[model samples]
Target: MSSFLTLSIVQSALELGCIYALVALALFVSFSLLNIADLSTDGCFTLGCAVGAVVTMAGHPFLAFFAAMAAGVASGFITAFLQTKMGVQSILAGIIVNTGLYTINLMVMGFSSNINLFNTNTIFSMAKELSESEVYRSWYKIIIVVCIVLLVCVFLAWFLNTSLGLSIRATGDNEYMVRASSINPGFTITVGLCVASAMTALSGAVLGQYQKSCDINYGTGQVTIALASLIIGESLIKKGSIFKRVIFVVLGSCLYRFIVAIALRMNLPAEALKLVSAVIVAIAISFPYLKEKAGFYKHRRDVMRQASKNV
Candidate 1:
């Protein structure tokens, strides 16, 4: 175990963890804050990768991020419009958008299954070139990802406290109440989903640049990954301020990546990793309920024993 758990392994895990945390943060906004299950995450993520890759290859590595986010915002608006105005169910709306995004993503990739950036400059490469110290140079990727995560966390924490942000939270808690207050629940929902999708796309953009390649299947199972990370974070933190919650979500992503790293070191086959993720997600989601049931049974047993003694 010690042999495989080297510093390089830890650093690699941290980089990936921080990058994926963006998606977890996105889930926090859509699922936790807005009470919406945006199933378009998987497709939106790939769309970001495709868009970022295309833009970066066009000599605009920095601009790729904004382009990808804009595409995601558009996707989110469509989903929101379908649900809020066209009377489609939220889940069904997400499904429709996700289905359409596949073709769109392919088109963005020039109908190709993959785009390689081996000869193209990426954000990570730019960061590497800008690093001054040898130590920092070695960790340029980590520095980039960590800074990005910190910025996102701080932005989300601040946004959630603003008036519009509060309204979005209210819409999540009770749309009827928001409507009663003339808050325009539809508008809040649209804003919430748009922001969430933008974050998700940004995550994909970073990942694409980090890998220096983008595949059509790059975002497969991203929804599961984000959901699992979010559940794990919530399970651990339980109750906290918005800032604390968002911070722990990043930590949870790191921990999840660490677990996956250890699993890989266990000589497990590649196919078994998905199963491990599923198990982890299931356990994380059910932990609170299981703990509650256990406590209830223990209390009942103690009460019965006390009654017997009294009798």
Candidate 2:
């Protein structure tokens, strides 16, 4: 590729990566910290997109973002209530909320399956208005969003190091132990889910504004994508400090986007995209396991060789 084309691809990858990183961070809170598989992300994301699109169309771009966040929090609350109060499994509760949000998102979008804000005032447009040069205007939106996401990640990492954050981590690691220490596991789960869903909502709002449209199917397979990103990030980074982990996650998201962009440029068949994603995730998730197995085989081979030589 030409240098300009390479630069363009890198730019697009970074922008898209930042967006996906937001979703992955949300999943990290629930999956990595809360020990819950939240399927509600798919619905909540779409709900946020729908709310943002509709509100922006109604001449309330800023409010639209918060509205979407509120919707996401409500969805999280419902799932939490189901799990904590109604005695449903966490995964099941997420499924219930996700299913419900489908209809709710449609309602929020004026009962339509999709809403296009192609010519409406969106967050990107607002950013453009605040900029002078066309190039700066084009870059400003992504830069602002990336900065916000990084701030959130930093805040989360710091929070996780706090007393309350420790409690949340304890709840994930050993709920029984946390309860023995007089901590409420239910509360921890609720709080984690709330934060996670809010992040997901923010991501959805940005995505809607970025694309100038919101579709019901926009969030389909989102959970898988988030999981894949998290797995890839975790695999790439050494588990040391919280700050390092957060940074690694962001880097992983960027790397994942770059890979996808390269695949697209190679003219990979659309039908193979899902398979590619699955393969990537599987390799990431199984890396440690594979390493262990390889070590075992090597040890066995060494022992056999030594025995044969002695014989």
Candidate 3:
């Protein structure tokens, strides 16, 4: 336990938490705001990593960010098209896109399963170069990610306040009401998914650059992880403005990563990580319901006790 609390391990967990917080934010948009279940997240994340890594290796680290986001936009557009035009269910559209993205991601990686960037110049490297002292250098990654997350949170807060953004949130709450009110729910859904997917891709790009490599399975089970983070965040902050919620999302991601770090310290095997993720998700999902159940039982017991005293 003490070893897990070491500075280096804590820093590593913080880095991972910051990276994955983007995905949690993405889920907040698609799942919470748009009421969409986008199962294509894993593939989209890998696609971003592959595209970003390939482009970064070509000596264009900055361009890699936009390139990866563009790929994510294309992926999002296809998923939206399938749902809006082809009449596919939202979940099915995501599955179809996720499946097709696997091949596309592979192609982007030059048909290889992994791309090593051992000597590659990535965004992290660029950030590190901007720092002077060794201490500042160690903090570069966190600073970069924190700045990006802050910008994103501010942008999202403003966006959600806009008319179109309000329409997106309304569409999620009641599509028929939005439709009857002269707003196109389809358009709102499309835009929301695109924005969400782009955010997820950005997360992958950051993770890939930070790790200094890209693997075919880099994004496996990422959606579950994001969902868990989101749920944990919601648990922490039940009701708040968008800005507050976004902050909680970041906090939740950090907490989730911290838990994983502790588990790893306990000598949990790599193969069991997914199961651990599933359990965390289960607890998060059931927390509210379980709490309510306990409350109900307590109330009933209290009522019976009161009646017995009166008798």
Candidate 4:
């Protein structure tokens, strides 16, 4: 490939990777920390895009971003309420919220199934307007996104070590124990879900601005993709420090994007991308089990060989 082509591919991968990393971080909070599946991610992502795009079209790009985050928080809170107050299962609550958000997002977008932000003032556009050089304009959006991701990682790391964060973690680890300690596990769960949803919403808002459009199905199967990135990051880092783990989550997002880029370069069909994501997640999830099984077989084989020799 030409140098320019390679550069373009790399740039695209980096941008997408950052977005994926945000989603993965959100998933890490919900799945790894809160122990909730939180399937509302798919709808919340689309909701962010829709909210951002509509508000951008109305001449308030920054407000649009925050609005999207607010919408995501609301969605998350609803799911939490359903699970905690109404006695609904977490997975079921997520599904219900996810299903409801489709209509809500559509309503937010004025019944349009999709909206384009091209030429409209977006957060990135505003950033470009502030910078004088064309080169700066081209790179500023990505730089801002990287900064946001880094800030989020640092904040999350610090938060996880705090008393409230510990309580949240405890809820995930052992709800009964947390309840016994007089900590409200439900409240912790709600807070965690809200934070996770906000992260996802931020990702969607940025991605929509970057692409200059918002599509209704933009977040299809996002949970699997986020899980894949999280697991891949965890496997690669294998460290216990919360700070390092968060950094690894971002790295894993980039790695997942790189893999997808390579797969695209190989000319994989667009229709198969979901399958690829599923396969990647499956392999990551099953790796420990597979390793244990292999070790067991190897040990058994060694014991049998030793017995035969003795006989």
The most accurate candidate by lDDT is: 1
TM-score of 3: 0.96
- Residue pairs in clash, model 3: none
Which segments of candidate 1 are over 4 A away from where they belong?
A: 301-311
Lowest summed-lDDT stretch of 10 residues in model 4?
A: 1-10
What's the lDDT for candidate 2? Answer: 0.85
Candidate 2 collision pairs: none
In order, what is each prediction's RMSD in angstroms? 1.6, 2.3, 1.5, 2.6
lDDT (Cα atoms) of all candidates against the true structure: 0.92, 0.85, 0.89, 0.87
The local distance difference test score of model 4 is 0.87
Tens-place lDDT digits, model 1, residues 1-311: 37879888999999999999999999999999899999999999999999999999999999999999999899899999999999999999999999999999999999999999989999888878885898988798998999999999999999999999999999999867886897988899999999999999999999999999999998889999889899888888978899999999999899889988898889999889789888888887898899999999999999999999999
Question: lDDT at 242 for candidate 1?
Answer: 93
lDDT score for residue 262 of model 1 = 91
Candidate 3 Cα outliers beyond 4 Å, as residue runs: none
Better-scoring candidate (lDDT), 2 or 4? 4
> Ten consecutive residues with minimal summed lDDT in candidate 2?
1-10
Which prediction has more favorable lDDT, 3 or 4?
3
| TM-score for all models, in order of appearance | 0.95, 0.92, 0.96, 0.91
Lowest lDDT 10-mer window, candidate 3? 1-10
User: Which ten-residue region of model 1 has the weakest summed lDDT?
Assistant: 1-10
**Model 3 agreement with the true structure over 10-91: per-residue lDDT tens digits:** 8888889988999999999999989899999999999989998999999998888788888888888889889988899999
